[model samples]
Target: MKYPDLFPFSWFKGFRPESNDNLETKSPLRQLADIISSSVDQIDATFKDRGQKYPNLDAPFDPTTPAEATALSPEVIHCSSLIVAACAHLSATVNIPTKLLFDVGGGFHLSAALGVIIEGNVVEILHDHPSGLGVYDISAKNGMEPTRLARLLRLLATHHVFIETSPNVFKNNKLSSMLDTHKSFDTIQSKPEDKYVGTSGISALFAHTCDEVMKGSAFLTETLTDPDIGASGAVEDCPLAVAFKFKKSFWEWLEEPRNEYRMNRFMLAMEGSAKLEPSDAILRGYQWGNLPPQSLVVDVGGSLGHIVREIRNAYPGLKYVVQDRPAVIESARQIWEKAIPSISDGSVVLQVHDFLKPQPILDARIFLCRGVIHDYSYSVAKLILRNLRDAATENTELLIIDTITPYACLDDNQARVGYGIMGTETLPPPTPLLANLGKANAVPYILDSQVLVVLNGEERTIGSFTELLKDSGWKITRVFTISGSSGKQILAAPV
Candidate 1:
């Protein structure tokens, strides 16, 4: 059976069409509507040209499929971002003030509900019964209350996560199935601790985000209000501690024996984050292949050496030293030993080191710090940078792979500073849209808050990064904003 078009005209039926006049003549609301309509048309055309249909919401998500691959094209991604931003803007503009505020306030219920179903393996259980499972049966399998499970599933269905096939039966849909661990229901029941291992990691990511991040966020107001810890940039006093009443830092807390599974899940969640980006996003950043043969590259705080494994495959001539905490280094060693034949060789060395300490390798060609610096305060980030700077030779380069946040409002300075050594310019959104692409470029802002709550850290703006780098005796040499990458690649050299 043929599914309807991805963005049917009826979807935009309520959006008013402006006259065929130029954009300046149209109102802001009309401009947003136009963006939505035009983006939808562009997305539709791209899929048709590719001879692929858009996946419907009713089906389960399969990223490996051709239809899903088509959605990854840069053109499709840009148009999708436009539609998401415009729709959100349009809704906020027209929504009733009281109703909008209440909806926003009650948003925690959604995350709470998701946390419940994910823990209960509701999606996995529902996956077996494609025809839809009765709430009573689902509860019997998952052990949630029948009535409560039905209510939670209903709420998710209203959000398009699942579908209510009948009065009390529910089935997994595209959005809901994304959280599936892909393990057998029996396997999950037998060993719940191993549910995240050898899985897609999406479920672990959701669990971490909803359970820990959501809990920490609950105390954001209180953390900000406390006179002693509120303005303290120390990691030990982060909002996570405020919520959990833990005396140790977040990392130290994760290392406790009781929290081993939590820590493992967190690592898997970090790896799962790569699923958000293109497969070769790491290679897209720095010019690894350009280096001379046998050039030494150090990966600081590189958990499991996953990023380096990709880079090593692409640039086989380069040698690597992957550094992290002891437990993480041991895990990386096991993984590398199995995956690479030359694991015993000195080509790829797994080192147990902390970024807080002084660096070890003094003559490396490049120091790769992916997803590391963002988890610290300015002072701590400076120390990490300074350590690398201290160990660097005159020719050494430092590649910081992390998000360089853009301001929400217009910033002429950012518009002028192009990314990458070739000076590739950033495209500004059309007039009436936000300068930072609104929700399109919202992750950095969202993560900024998340890191603040959890680690007393933040996702840095380009300006913040520049200042931090300069203070640590490094200069921003170039930056590469790779397509589908979670962050920009900021390449620096010792000043």
Candidate 2:
């Protein structure tokens, strides 16, 4: 009945999503790290391309290339975007209320880190980052004593944390929020009361994707897969691994961390994204008004019951249940008891069942799967569908919600994302030439070399799903999309 703006992402909003509610700007110590890293990358690229001669290193910055883009990938600077993505994972795992926590963490990480740089000054930071301190607090505990004012001021000015109002006085902005633990731009008096930037989107998720290649891209996926799991290290090659290895290995890497720093950050990132809100925002675009406010929608592999809670909120009289692994169920129980729910009135029922096993029978009118089925291999996914089919009564509606790949081919097409919950991807072979030994592109041909990398699974195209579903005795009846941007749809009937 009362759906808070369900979908709110604008693709052309230029760069990273910033709250229109602007924040007081202060330069944080971390901005220095960001700047130094940017400068080094530009010089490296330029040197590598232009050769030994420094063609009159005249104008240090090249006007053509964007300073930030040339320095670091957009993904790195867009920590806010990282929060948005992480929130989905967290909602899927823990539930929705914590979205606020993540939002705050991200925004704060930006504000505080930047604030430190502004007050201390950025120039000196570029030279060296002191012990246990980022760019901020380097001089704070002591004050310009050993750190040198000119060097420090130069770094600070270069950091651009604040624009000079007079001489050292500066202007405040969203970027400036990084400076103070509290308030006042160019004040330089003392750390604000709200200490450590008052946690927001900068939480664990930011560190996870930015630090680990495994979490951000498919390096781990590519590396773990051994296309030739066979003795000779040669095979026909597995498409599933190639298509979805990126996400699969990321979670695998997530489960394993070198230290508490890595461990805490990764968990936080995941916790941030696990919301009832569907990743594609299709829920916002479509109208559920037609359906007679169904009794309840049960989510399979639903983490932390976030989806259950969100759906419950969306359809007043309707209720929800989240089905997941025993360990995950335990985690969900813990999260719900401690935090707030994203919606009111709608209740959540938790069901623990192995997807590889059977679906628990319930009276729910709609059986929903969001980014769920994509986690399993075709055979495994089909088995999941069969389990749901066996459990569904004629009155029950089976809704399979996931990203569907269009059959049409594009010159530079990107593959759809995997469900990203629980599934494994087979490793790529040592050598495509030798490892792509005998497996044909189509089915009926057994894979000579396929090894599960662990937890990461396969991604599928609609045509691929069509064939797989047919084999499993289900027929697709209708297709749904999120205003044609991110989410997918499928209305299926049992054979």
Candidate 3:
């Protein structure tokens, strides 16, 4: 009856119905409040234990500080998730239905305001003005109307993004500073096309999400109601196609010459997505060091070979072949040839290969697909998996690294038969809380809608993954949950 030592302490003990936990007898509201209070206590103690103070929201963000990494530690992350989930659930429990609906429906305005500020370089403009900047001064610098800019900024300030100092004056806070590209306002103004070229990619992510995904999502109902496209499951029939009137799939549309800026922004936005997860997330599950020396590990659809480079850096003996579209392979060649010696010595090979076709590297000891499958519909995902399966030998292992969503309610069946070993258990949240941990596990659900709007894809549950792999001639062997990452590593072998 003992669970795996996944957490620091046995806090999860007695949460089940069969256990002697007293939380089950309390009112749901009280239980949620207790969850928040206890989680905050844990977070407070941890910060004090490390001789660090909890970060202040009023101050600008400083990622260079060692406390930034400490904030992302697994234990802290879990506690934070519990607090967020409990607080949100409690708020919903007490709020009026009409008011809750209004807030949920009006959420797009936040995205619109964020896009305006990021595009206007407001964060960069406010970077030097630590004290505050008046609306007129900001308008003079950015050319936006003073009153209109004030209204937009006030909206964001209300949401705790920026901070309003005095009347008509605003300053960047920690939440808003994340959008700062650190570029000079002049450079951003002069080279509009290159604003996101050398930055942290956060601004680019904001631009793409607010501009493209937000626009496309507006036609979600229309796309769903249309019989011809709704049931087709074709990427060309997605909501983006309906909103933009484009016949091509999302990737093909990005390739058009007129959309070069958008294409570049999309690429950088993906890099920003990777930054959202832990840097060592990819190394958590699989035993890369155990592979034979010089074993070829082919990274399929590996844009810029970032994942392969990380693996090669950690486990140098394993050779790699990073395959992608021609343009991506050329980009990898250009970026890596100068920076990485592995490319020069032929230890890492960059080849252009489409996953829709049969894989070329038949001798691969491991076929690694990271964050590639979720960008396609089930039909397209099947094509990618079947291709890998066709090329995989008896000894070749396939590692799929992506999010595995959990259900909201309790599940006895999945807990019993899901992809886990005898000793390790995937712990559920305590009673009176959502089984999936609700808002704490909100990223994958947000990404589900994200893929639907952008590429007609989806984040899958464990059952969905099992069905897909079974249909593609692979059998699941093990699943390893990565610490501080929404994504899990699912290892399978050719059936």
| lDDT on C-alpha atoms for all candidate structures | 0.82, 0.43, 0.82
Model 2: lDDT of residue 344: 35
In candidate 2 the C-alpha lDDT for residue 257 amounts to 42
Q: How much does candidate 2 score in TM-score? A: 0.46
| Residue 342 alpha-carbon offset, candidate 2, angstroms | 14
Error of 3 at 200 (Å): 1.4
The RMSD (Cα, Å) of candidate 2 is 17.9
lDDT of 3 by residue, 1-495 (tens): 111112221133222233436865788898888888887888888899999988789998887676666676666766777777888889889999899899899999988988888888899899989999999999999999999899999999998999999999999999998888888898889988999987778889989998989999999999999988886668898899899999988988999998999999999988876776667777877989889999999999898999998899899898999999898899899999888855778899999998989998888899999998888888889989999999888899999888777777766766665545321245567656677777666767888898998889889887788889899988888888765555778888999
Each candidate structure's TM-score, on Cα atoms with residue i matched to residue i, is 0.92, 0.46, 0.92
